[model samples]
Target: MSVSLMDFHADWCGPCKTQDPILDELKNDWGDRFDLEKVNVDEEQDVANEYQVRSLPTLIVENDDGVVERFVGVTQREDIEDALERAGA
Candidate 1:
């Protein structure tokens, strides 16, 4: 069972900029314990639509069991870490 963090963002989004580094740090710190998938909404519209992401910086946390949480806007590191913990990352 593996956990994944799907980050839906665009190049022109300001809040997404704030969200990126936090996710990057988590990806580096957690290593193989979790997977981080960065989705560029401008390029991957289908993926963004499939997730029904209407805004920038949508973070979807999922595991083998399925989605654990979905966050929009500039999410805090603690909240994301908590979701990862719940997803058994």
Candidate 2:
């Protein structure tokens, strides 16, 4: 199962900044277990719209089967890890 984490955020979002470090840490720890892609809402509005993102700091965990989990606002590391686990990463 291939898993990917899409972080939808903008440069002006404070919560999105707060979310960044957590994602970076996860990337360091998890390594290649999952793919992490940061989508700037301002630059990648189409992708954000495709995901139906209504807010900043939206995290979508998807496997080959598609989206497995969606998180809005600031999220904890453990929660993300759980989602990755569920996605079979």
Candidate 3:
């Protein structure tokens, strides 16, 4: 099965910068299993607000099946793997 990974971040946010590498690692490792999209809060406020992301580095792992998990803050890479596994990736 396939999943949708949405990352909400802003350019000026420090946490967003810190989380970028982690997300890059995740993408390189899991790209084949999921469709990853990065949405900037500044440019994609509609999407960000819809997801109720109050933080800079928010991650939403969803599918056409709907969101399986919503993570707020700088998530650990292993935790992300766990979420993917729980989502049946």
Candidate 4:
């Protein structure tokens, strides 16, 4: 089962800017180990609401089983990797 990282962010969010690069680096480094999906809250309001994303840079880590972790605000790369590991990515 592939792990997915759903990044809920908006263009005007400063913290999301900071979080983007970290997730990009991980996506480059990991390469096919997991799926990284960026959800622009402005454009994807329904998806954001479904996930109950109330903050910028919310990282939702999930796999076939279900959601493994949900993090709000800027998150550390290590923490995200830990969540991926937990999801058996």
lDDT of 3 at 80: 80
User: How do the residues 1-89 of candidate 2 rate in per-residue lDDT, one tens digit apiece?
Assistant: 78999999999999999999999999999999999999999998899999999998999999999999999999999999999999989
RMSD of 1: 0.7
lDDT of each: 0.94, 0.96, 0.85, 0.95
What 10-residue stretch in candidate 1 is worst by lDDT?
A: 21-30
Query: Would you give me the overall lDDT of model 1?
Result: 0.94
lDDT of 1 by residue, 7-63 (tens): 999999999999988998988888999999999999999999999999888999999
Model 3 residue 79 CA deviation in Å: 0.6
Collision count for each candidate, in order: 0, 0, 0, 0
Q: Candidate 4: global Cα-lDDT? A: 0.95
Residue by residue across 1-89, what tens digits does model 3's lDDT show? 77877889988989888888998888898778877789999998998889898987999988667889989888899988888777777
* Order of models, best TM-score first: 2, 4, 1, 3
Better of 2 and 4 by lDDT: 2
Give the least accurate 10-residue stretch of model 2, judged by summed lDDT: 40-49
TM-score of each: 0.96, 0.98, 0.91, 0.98
Off by over 4 Å in 1: none
Per-residue lDDT of 1-89 in model 4, one digit per residue for the tens? 98999999999999999999999999999999999999999999999999999989899999998899999999999999999999988
